[model samples]
Target: MNSDEIKTGEERPTRNKWNLILGILFLAYGSYRLYQKLQIPDDDNFGMILAVGFIFFGIYDLWKYYKGV
Candidate 1:
């Protein structure tokens, strides 16, 4: 293959690694927020929603990683 035709298949793994890392971070943060929400009484307004949103986003990232997207 010519130099110009040489393709490095490294981007996918790098991208996936980043996605996985970010996904885990988001998931952890979400879980922590959820725990905090449970610990705090009479504050069941937006914290739960935010936690769920973050968890969903993390799951999406994992899905994307699996799909190689």
Candidate 2:
């Protein structure tokens, strides 16, 4: 309880490695989808939506990991 004391294992928030990796993968997949869509003008709106969703969730995961939220 000391002001200068540091929190140990159980008291500290731990980052989820799996979440981090998933986030990275999601981002990569989203980017790839977007790129493919750009290369094909006939791409459907669904593709864009999926890409955006993936990117958004990926960013959310990374944010949670880094911000400990």
Best by TM-score: 2
Worst 10 residues of 1 by lDDT: 7-16
List model 1 lDDT by residue over 1-69, tens digit each. 697788877555434687888888888999898888888896687879999899899988977777677
What digit string (tens of lDDT, one per residue) describes model 2 on residues 1-69?
A: 796587555556678887788889898899888888889978499989999899888888888777666
Each model's TM-score?
A: 0.71, 0.76
The collision pairs in model 1 are: none
Model 2 C-alpha lDDT versus the unseen true structure? 0.83
The residue-level lDDT of candidate 2 at 3 comes to 60
Model 2 lDDT, residue 22, Cα = 83
Off by over 4 Å in 2: 1-12
Residue pairs in collision within model 2: none
